[model samples]
Target: MQPLLIYNTLSHQKELFKPLTPDHVGMYVCGPTVYGDGHLGHARPAITFDVVFRYLRHIGYKVRYVRNITDVGHLEHDADEGEDKIAKKARLEQLEPMEVAQYYTNRYHAAMDALNVLRPSIEPHASGHILEQIELVQKIIDAGYAYVSNGSVYFDVRKYQEDTKKYGCLSGRVIDEMLSTTRELDGQEEKHFSGDFALWKKAAPEHIMRWNSPWSVGFPGWHTECTAMGTKYLGETFDIHGGGMDLMFPHHESEIAQQTAVCGHGPCKYWMHNNMITINGQKMGKSLGNFITLDEFFTGKHELLDQAYTPMTIRFFILQAHYRSTVDFSNEALIAAEKGYARLMQAYKTLGRLQPSKTSSVDVKEYRQKCYDAMNDDFNTPIVISHLFDMAKVINTVNDKKATLTQADIDELKGVMDTFVFEIMGLRDEASSDNTALIDGLMKMILDIRATAKANKDWATSDKIRDELGTLGVTVKDGKDGATYEL
Candidate 1:
């Protein structure tokens, strides 16, 4: 088996992945904030890491994947300057903060389910881990890398840089440049330096998500939640930490700083980040006002969408690009993806019904190793998909009676398709799941009737049945064995 080589954002190169503990892997990914509906931006990281989780398990590793939910302390500006995003929504709607969080959280889960994103092993809410966050903040303060001011505590970025000289190691930021250009924000006047971020913020009088801590009645900062929750669930140092490329600057950089301050080392061995989904070459995000929610994409309710797309189509679209590459969305792109998904599923069905010949005319055994090679190369999904499409063409040729494969080759091709197409890539046949049994029975009966018509030499009745079914978006084909239908 080829060793997995993943690109580490910290090292800026692909490195061989070796787990800390034998046969076990720990991965932590930054999950949704849950103040609003999940968008294309949110789906990128969720689906990207879900593949990582699936492949790790599929390769015989005991994987504990932790994805955190930021239910509180995520402010309007991701820094400590603005209103809490969830609390602001709750105030606007005149509801409790947790009510808003739970409502949107449920919606996020629903969208993820529709996208076929597998749920993480542990989904920790920031609100549920206040004590751990407070303890982490205390550790930073005790280590002299943080300070208390005005009932709130802030990480001392200047002190951390002065001591360790590694404050921006992951982000490649120069401390001098950051200190010179950093914008001063509200409630940050008490900080020792403008670049220092909040560990815990003292709750304002109107803040809805307040918790008791040594500094004040407050909540954990946006950066502290992941550090605390990840450490609590996956230990101080895990195998992989992943999120979006947009978070490389302050979010993940701060996570490294906090963990270094506490444990004298960074949190993870390898840091992975998936690139963003863009609209017309611009990043699609809630803050950008250009994001189309997953629901909008599904229903074609958004102004930008040309047609409604299924869950599997969306999943296939994302998988068509490498996780590290920016995928720009357009109507033409998604329509192409939908057609490609349909063909892939059709080829899979054809593979299942293929008859083995006495001898082989094509070699099908190499596809399995080829797929494993693609997966081993930093989870390069597009290459894997290209290989699958190549095999799909072969399957089509064989179905057309233009090629033949022995039983062993046929079984190997089936295993390759099943393992890579459905298992690792995480695509399902939407048609198979959407009342397929009923449709299969109906198609069987209709085909049987058509067969009877042909057997009785009633050409008019058979032709009428075939033409009417074709008008209803079903194609009927007559073969030597029997008649088959495609919907």
Candidate 2:
């Protein structure tokens, strides 16, 4: 294993990862809010951390990965007058709040499944962890970092800063500046300062997702649930906490404040944030009305999409760029990714058939080390992908007799490509997942009929079958051993 250095957002530098327990790691990533369909913004962080999870396991570490489902406590606005996102959506739809949560949670899971992201070890939901959240709020109050305003408990941002001087250390915002910039609203009369955030929000009479806390009948604050559930599962101090770059501010900053108040320190050692997805160089977000859902991209239903893109193409498009870079979505980029993915898979198939010669032309061992080096340096996936393309070029050269490889080298090349392409990167062939059994059976039947026609010397029948299948977008090729077709 190579030394893995991850970019830590707290220190604003890349540092060598040193887990508290030797050969063991703990990670927690912020999951979806589950109030609506997942958009491209949701996919970026999911896939980014999925790569981190995969590569951590590959490096021979025992990992406890916990990504939480936020079913409640996320407000549409940052102010006190804001409504719960789930409750607001449910109120408009005339459905139960939990029903809305469950429906979108299933949809989110399905979309993640299509992207081939691995499930986290523990996906604790916010609704089911009210007791934990209540206990955490009590901890903050006991620490003298929070206060009860009317019926709700608020985290005293100014007082916490006075105690630790660590407030705004992660986000680099001056506490005084934040106080001036935050809104002064109609419903914030209980708060002593405009920047103070609710640890427990008193529920409105019509609020659907109310819980019984010591303070009042209300719901947990948007930022408190993560702190409670995170410490509950990954301990007070853990290895990594990951989310989108958009969350680097207020949300994660608030999370850090709550956790530090309770535990006497920041929660996680390494904070990783993946950059957002942009459209035409502008940020793609729901508020901007430029967001495109995953289903819309899959069906090519959005006006911005030129054609329906496959799951693999979407995955490859994301992986082609460094995780920390903002990936812009466009039809030309997606089409190029689809073509590049096809070429890489074809080379993978070709490597299996490349005949070994008496001598070798390429040193696959060096390429294997380079692949590891790419991933080791902050999980730079674009560099690893570039290395994969270089290997593909070697495979093509050997297959075309422009280069030669010994049997041992050929076997090593296969192992290296398999480990990097399939295991570490977690990419799969698109054809294998789309109606696999039916397509395989249909192709087998069609090829068998073509073979029978050729065996009988029925040129007319064989050529017609081949020509008609071509008209339907299937290409058939004959060789010495047999025939193969691809769609």
Candidate 3:
């Protein structure tokens, strides 16, 4: 099998993964801001990195995955002068700031859990770590990389650029380019340069989430919490730092500068970014008003959707494409994915019932190696699914007695399916239930009646039983070997 090769944003190339420690790996992903319900945009990184977390553990690494929840310090997209995002939402809804965060955080987890995403090992909240944020700001100030103005602290971009010589490497941005491209904002008189960002913002009297710090009664900057919380949990240097590609600039770039200025070294060994989900070839962002919330998609509440899609269908749609490629959403595409997902899942169910023969007809070992190779190649899930489809074809042929499988081959095939489908891909058989015994007994009784009808050449009775069961959400398929039913 090929060694895992992940595309590193810092190096701008796909490099072989070598952990800093032999058996341990630390990964930090920038998580939700919790100001609103999670949209389709949020699912990308959660599902993408969940696979990374799963694969790393599957390959024998003890992984620590830290995904933070940002309950504070986010500003409106256009107006840095505007109110905190969560605070603004709370005022509109007449609720406390923490109340808003808790409500949406619960909703976000429910959506992700429905999609079968693995929960992160450590999910830290920004509001819970104000002291650590203040200490980090003080460290930057003590290092002469930040200065105070009217009880507010701002990182000195010019000073850090002069000291480090490369400030915007992750964003592929030059200092001159930022000075030229960045729009002038209203309350930036305190900043010495256009590229300088806030380490702490002095809160207005009306601000409800203010905390007292050495700077003033203020809130930490949007970028400061990630640097502080990430370092606090994962140490100064870790294995992989991941987020959406949109965060590659400004947010992640600022994070690198802050960490480097304080620790005299960069934060992580590898940087990974998942590409955006698009609509009509444009990025789907909250500010753009083009995004559909996960709830909206599942409930068919969006004007653009034709009908609701199950969580497994959404997961299958995402895994059908490479993580690095932008996946465009459409009703047609979703319908296709839904059908394809059902076919694969049905085959997975059929594999268990196949009888083993003395002689093997399929090369199961080679097929298993291909599955591993696809995953090792930058976690290529699309290709892995293609391999699964091939396996499905073989399983179907063998079920028809056109092919054969030895006992060892049967065991290896089952292991491969379980690893790729359940463990690495993070997909579940959503149709499964604990009431299988009851459902199976009922279906058997109905099938017995149908068998009697068929034996008596009463086609009308047999067809009625099949049609009625189909309307009740159970599919009955008849073949020469036997009749099977699935719900």
Candidate 4:
């Protein structure tokens, strides 16, 4: 078997994956803010890391995957300036902040479930870990890397940079350039340097979500949540930390600084980031008007969609591209993905009904190894998909009586397809065989009733049944022997 080589964004290269402990992995990925409906952007990271979680477990590793829910502390602007996103939503909707968070969090989970994304082993909410974040702030203060500014506490980027000279290592940003180029926000007057970020923000009297901390009545800064929660759950250093590429700069860079300041080292061994889903080459996000919610895609309610696309089609569309590559959304692209998914599923179905022969004409074992190779090379999903397509061709050819496979070879092919397509890649037949059988039985009964109506010359009843079935997107065909339905 090829050794798994994951691309570490920190190292900027693919490295052999070696868990801190044998056969155990601790991975953390930044999850949604949950202030609004989960859009196409949210789906990318959830599906990407879900595959990582799935593959690690499949390969005999016990993985602890922690994805945080940012219910609070994330400001309207990504920087520490604007109103809290959840709080703003709460105010607009005339509900408690937690109510807004809970509603959106539930919606996010539903969207992820529809995409077949597995739930994380641990999902810690930032609002729930106030003490942990406060302690983290104090640690940075004790380390002399952060300082109290008025009632708020700010991480002293200049001091940290001067002491360790490692402030921008993860993001490859020079501290000097950052300080000079940093924009002036409303609270910039309190910071020693423009580049300094908030560790704790002193809440105004009107701030809905405020906690009584050692400094003041305040809330943890946006970056403080992940640092505190990750350390508490994954220990000082863990195997992997992942999120979208958009977080690489301020958010992830700040994480590195905070962890390095307190622990004298960074948080994780590897940093992984999946690229964005874009519209007209612009990043799709809640802040951006172009984002289409997962619900919109499923219902075809959005102006951009021509027809409703199933959840499986969306998942297949994401997997057809490498995680590190940008995916530009288009109606044409999605339609093509739907067709490709159908072809793949059809081939899998054909493989099950294939007959075994005494003589084998094609090699089956090599494809299994080729798939392993693709996955090992930084989870190259596009290549793995291509290999699966080739395997599907072989399955189609064998089914067409153009090639033969021994029973052993046939079994091997089945195992390979099952492991890669379902177990590892996490794709399932949308039309489950059991469900199909049930639908078939119901349709048969309905058609039988319709036939009796026609036989009895009850033209009104027969026409009504036919028209109703048509409305439901089912067509009834009268054949020589009986009636059959197409859905």
lDDT of each: 0.89, 0.89, 0.89, 0.89
| TM-score versus the correct structure, for each prediction | 0.88, 0.89, 0.88, 0.88
Please provide, for model 3 over 1-487, each residue's C-alpha lDDT reduced to its tens digit, 9 standing for 90 to 100.
Answer: 6999999999989899999999899999999989888888899899999999999999999999999999984753326554777887888889998999999999999989988899999999999999999999999999999999877788899999998986988988889988998787866787788788888888988677889998799899888888998899899999999999989888999999999999998889999999989875677776776779998888888877899988888999999999999999999999999988988888888889899999988777777899899999999999999999999998899999999998888888889989999999988887784477888998999998999999999999999999999988689989887789987
* Per-residue alpha-carbon lDDT of candidate 2 for residues 115-221, written as tens digits (9 for 90 to 100): 88999999999999999999999999999999998899989999988888988888898888987787777557888888888888889887889989889999988
- Those runs of model 1 whose alpha carbons end farther than 4 Å from true positions after fitting are 76-80, 285-289, 436-487
- Residues 61-106, candidate 4: write the lDDT tens digits: 9999999999874753435455776777688899999999898999
Clashing pairs in 2: none
- Which 10-residue window in model 2 sums to the lowest lDDT? 73-82
Candidate 1: tens digits of C-alpha lDDT, residues 75-184: 53435466887888899999999998898899999889988889999999999989998999999999988999999898999888888898889889988888787776
RMSD of 3: 10.1
**Candidate scoring better on TM-score of 2 and 3:** 2
**Ten consecutive residues with minimal summed lDDT in candidate 1?**
73-82
